[model samples]
Target chain A: MTTSTFSERGAAAVGSAAAAAVGDGARHLIEKRAAAVDAYPAMDAMRDRVREIRLHTLAHLDAYLADFADSVEAAGGHVFFAADADEANAYILGVAGEAGAELVVKSKSMVTEEIELNGALEAGGLTIVETDLGEFIVQLSGDRPSHIVAPVLHWTKEQVGHLFADQLGVPYADEPTELNQIARTHLRRIFLRADMGISGVNFAAASTGTIAIVTNEGNGRLTTTAPRVHVAVMGMERVVPTVEDLGVMLEVLGRSATGQSLTTYTNLITGPRRPDDDDGPDEFHVVIVDNGRTAVLGDEVSEVLACIRCGACLNICPVYRTVGGHAYGDVYPGPVGSVLSPILFGFEGREELPYACTLCGACLEVCPARIDLPSLLVNLRERVAQEGTAFSWLDRPLDAYEFAATHPTMWTASIDGASLAGRANRGGWFKRLPWRGKTWTSVRNLPAPAVTSFRRWWKKHHGA
Target chain B: MAAHTVSVLDATEGPIVVPSGSCAAMMIDHYADLLSDDDALAAAARRVAGRVREFTQFVVDDLGLDGLEADATGPITFHPSCHGLRHLGLRGYGERVLDHVGVERRPLEAAEECCGFGGLFAVEMPEISGALMETKIGHVEATGAETLVGYDMSCLMHLAGGMRRRGTDVEVRHIAEIIAGEDEA
Candidate 1:
């Protein structure tokens, strides 16, 4: 197929999948999510539980992660701690090389995405297939995930219908069930013929060394069981102290994510095919990726690690609703993405991401784990400014303003000058403004500053 | 001193009187929190949950600003900053307020989103932050709105800097200031 044809088909497939995933009320998905979540009586209970679990886990992350590694090793699985994406990808590719793997079937793993694993594996001449329905659509489209939980949320149904017909050799159909069935059929064959299974861990239990994978479809289970070797890629933050904490997290994950009581499938795989087991993989490996998360730990923004990938912030975000995830232009999106993307990718390409929020605090309000999203976004923005990344033109004036505000003499003189100008422009607002202030008046009216500045009014009233 | 007895009006449909914009935003956000209690709070919360309109919404809906005034003859554009657009869901509320005040509402390109002030976000991510604000200023300049009105003061302040740096003729005012007819010199 031509490159353009492929892109068109991919775009169409993703659009249809998103429509299916989002269901109806596409115009007002955020409002609908608010209403649906508002009506759910169990949401509050789940949020409380999830908050407690995350707090406890983050407090003892080091101990739990070490124990998890120990348990996995004891269960006949090897654990690798990769400090960054390059190291993680190199290690995974090295493993694939050792195994002499050619064809790999994978489940949805954001950690792998973070490391850009497919590119590395593909470079090694390995044919990789993404089995998860959403991941499959993204792979076919060659698009990055717009959401944490729902990857293809940007597309409409008609788009997906067109994609499936062109790429999968199926007739155009937008109905969710038909499209899902089509994907399932295509990926089933890939799973049965795969040499290795790669998946992301939702929660790693330290007590039992079990990796939990939650999904609505049964793709995750198949990806693990059908392949001879199962490789689980996880961020270091994915571990919980025990299965009890995992249970609480799972409860919150389902409710806060999609308002479901439970995901259709929740698989806990402890190791490869056991000696007496009827069906499972023969070899198991766990890759723990630090990827800037260690730097985030012990910081004021460490509270971000508590995220369970629920995508609650995406559903409720006003900005995301309008521009969608691509506007942020990162692997993550919405309120959480605004804070995390800059920290991970550095503030170069994603400088606009932090400023995209209204600081309305909606993300913090709905976060099941109670992450202080607005504060973190603010903190990250401050860091970016302090690093002198802000445009010089704006920065100089802001610095000058800050300096003047801190100095009583300069501040008073400036206020007096502004007040005089306000009086001169009184009875009619200034059609033109001075300096960068013109940017504001250029679009809307500058209320000609107050004829009497607020400071002046306060001084008169309070005898300052 | 006049005792301003602003009635803490309870929306029989949403929630009770919520004073602050952030607090009202919070109410719509944590609607579940408002409903987790007894029937009284639940009913009250539901009534005010989605019903907590912004100051602009109240002005346009209750005061009927459009009916009171004819056409406002001036170059007027609006900035729908984060609080008004994202938190308060007041996309066109400012226009409705301005239209009622008899002001000429000029169409501004990319006027519906944030100006990147974001309270502390401007200080935090200053470069990207200023870049966003500059984008907003460019759109504002393109509109040639002699007056730029929004619901939040913080955004106006940030935009004020961009305007001053570029030496544009745009002015910034709060929606409340305009609606209360306090914009008159």
Candidate 2:
């Protein structure tokens, strides 16, 4: 299909599947964040603090990760560093096997999605239940996440009603509060009966050897606490040097992410449940997954790792606003998604994603982590086009333009030819033209060039 | 090396000629940059800067282009791009130029919003960038203007691609030829 038809159909699909997924997702996120805009003077102030914390932590990543692993091991817990997604999945499945974990309760975690961990575990004969409300909805519907922060953003309340009725054998309800209550009651059983809890860490403190999980729904708290063995998976980059840095980052993260002064619950897990702690997991396993991120860090575009998964860029993005996130056809959507997806998945399947923008600076303005989004997008496009990673057709025009740009004589000739042709067709404008120019004029009128080119005018007037 | 010197000419009453609106505004805001202590550099800067007036402002105020007999028939929407509005502060210059050419100026909604075609940005963040252009195209469609005229070619180029992709029927033109009454030529 043509880009227009594809986008039009894709937009309609996204619009219909969920009660205006983008709008509802935006409304939910905005309502939450608007409360904090007044609470935080400027997004920049919080952003700068977050940047410092992330930078400081990244600098000491190795040392902190080692310390965190040491702590988990000392407290009779297990720690594994998976070089890639497959390795991470294999390691998690092995742990499930050792513990004989049949039913696994999971909190919202992007790392698991990255590693495809749940599928691996399920393949290993474990029934994994996602406890987070948004994640549970997506899991039930067997749909991929539309938004990073709000996974089931593409699903409307009515869709949720259908999915719940079909999957959980529950009565259909359209009210958000009612659906949420139904999900809560159903998930509460999994939380109580699960043999293992799998969760993603927001930040890991190197100094105290602690894992931090920030959530609004409190499902993360339950998932981590209810099971006998809690398995925490995190990206290698998700570490902080000290507790102070964690405190600073948390302040910025919650405020910038959901616009909450603080997430309803911020759980810090240190080496499993303590000996005296009544209701906490006894065995803790911290899995550090480094799938392509280490390679990303080595590149100039490593700054993308600084993303906190706030989805602020997505929320404010005009492109994401109009066509929604699915058009990009990636796990992550919107501005940050465009840059990171190509790097993570390579450009072969996603060549169309880069060509879909006007480069407005809104995404850059709203990013709380202050990622140089526009520059990264440009860098990726150049990589895709010039490097011949994908979309080989783009090279022709680019090369032609490059050649014309370099050879001034040819450039001037082309301009003059264009001007002459334009003048000839100038009843008012050229409705169509030959070659690629026709591609442009096919949809809109091309202004016929002046009878004289600018260069010619300069020569005539200034006697160059 | 020759030492630079400055010469102040008596203000001329005729049209103040300028090459571009951005440079013209710079002359007004940073005129001090032109008047260096060195006389020759000062004269050269002033001479160059003096030619940087808004096409319409220059024509209406300096050249009397508006008084000339011109065919003003077509209804065109005026989009004062950021550089022209923010950098040059040539507010309403495009409108005045269009009016002079005898074209009816159709006002566009959210006309001031960036078209997301920042030179390198179009290729960079295509998704978000395209999203912004969608908003811009929506505004242009709302105007129902036959032709979308703006001062910047870069913005038009990006918008033209987007309009094509969306299969919209609106024409983009530079303000220069429109005001010069050169569209027919």
Candidate 3:
């Protein structure tokens, strides 16, 4: 769906969910987040440092990535580079096939979502179960994550209660404790029996040839440990220079992501289980996927690669808060998604995602990486304007507006034209109009053109 | 029109004040970059950009808070459009304009948030826009003020539309009009 339709649907959905704990959750998020950032008075400095580190790393990404790959190799792990989604999926499937893996447990990896891994694995007749509670719920409902950080922000207790009852054959319960316990029971069976596991890398450290995964749940550990074959997918840009750099990134990541000092789980894995190690996969593989990331690295929006996937931009974004995440129609959502998705996937159908924001600059202030999301959105808007994808309808009206706005005579005439049109109309508003303005009148009435334009009134009475 | 506006700005080097914050912000922040490929136009745009000012800012800068004489009765609140609040970093100039006009000021909750007009965005995402407007209007209603005031007329327009649709008696006015004391009636 286009942004309009998505927003239209989202509005109805949010309105209904307001009395159903969504409001409480939003309130908690607001207060906790305020406290989180406010407690760290030097949050801006931390953000700046992280951004600088990311910028420097992205500039030398090839070297860091190569170093990371070699490090992984030295640590007794294999690395595969996939240029596209299909390649990434095929490579993972090939690894799963070699391991003779059937049931594969997955932690919440948006990279997997980006590559549509579950579908690919399903087609290959492999069962993939999402081990993260929220992902499991989303998987059960066959629904997309509506918020990047809180996947089921769109799902209320009542909805989840119903979903669990219907899908998990559990006794219906709306309480958080009951719901979580129910999920824990179901996901544990999959965790133990799964032959392979897949996860997303949050930060890959070139210094140690290590990958760190941050999660609030133990599922990440369970998913990484239980399977004999472990596969991790990472976008090429999510690498840091050193373990110390990873430490700094972590300090900001949890704080910025969910206002936590640290996530419950921050596991730094080097390779499969060593002989001394009690339990881990004998074979470990890291699938480094470009999938249009390298293209985004050199462009005007390369700063988007500075994103830490902390979802701070998403949490602070008003557009994401209102329309939710699905409106973006991309793996990533909110401010970062607006910039990154268009650059990664091209802006054919999803042009409105960039324009979806009011250019509020809220995302910029709260971002750990300090990626100037609004600026990048504007750049994307210009690119979409050039492509004439979703902006073609805007071309003529914008052209006419440009003509009228810049030409003093035309500008002067247009005011009078508006005055005349105001008089010609019902002396109030066009309740509903056709053509370009069709949507404006859908929810709110547009005031009829003024009887006298401000410029005209200023010029005439004030002698401008 | 672009050429003419550029020329006009060139001709009148000062005093190009606009009531709409977004209008001023576009020229001030975006015009040169928008016209970057055309050297002359871009240069001209830079000339125009440097001189433009938002209305409330202009009012405060030129006249100070003591310029106006009209005393507005009861409670009044100034709504800060996102363009003014976030984009241009406008803080209290609009309210200062209202104060200059002798209007009683009431603090609005969520004052710096966008009213969701967003030019065509209000139309394109009417549902979300309307939702935000509802939240804003709820704040306005919470203020229990007879008048809703703002620097941008588009914000007023959206608020007014919501008020009308909701059958509320609240009045929305531009800071310029309020400063002129035109709403004393």
List TM-scores for all candidates, in order. Answer: 0.69, 0.76, 0.92
Highest TM-score against the true fold, candidate: 3
What lDDT does candidate 2 reach at residue A76? 71
Q: Which run of 10 residues does model 3 chain A get worst, by summed lDDT?
A: A18-27
lDDT score of residue A269 within candidate 1: 90
Candidate 3 displacement at residue B174 in angstroms: 1.9
Q: Model 1 over residues A329-384: C-alpha lDDT tens digits? A: 66787788878777776677665566666675667767888888877877776776
List fnat per candidate, in order: 0.10, 0.17, 0.56
Q: For candidate 2, what is the interface RMSD?
A: 8.0
CAPRI-style grade of the A/B interface in model 2: incorrect
Model 2 chain A: lowest-lDDT 10 consecutive positions: A1-10
> Which stretches in model 3 have alpha-carbon errors above 4 Å?
A1-30, A423-427, A459-461, B60-63, B66-70, B95-102, B183-185
Q: Relative to the unseen true structure, what is the C-alpha lDDT of residue A176 in candidate 2, on a scale of 0 to 100?
A: 90
**Candidate 2, A422: how far from true, in Å?**
1.6
Candidate with maximal DockQ: 3
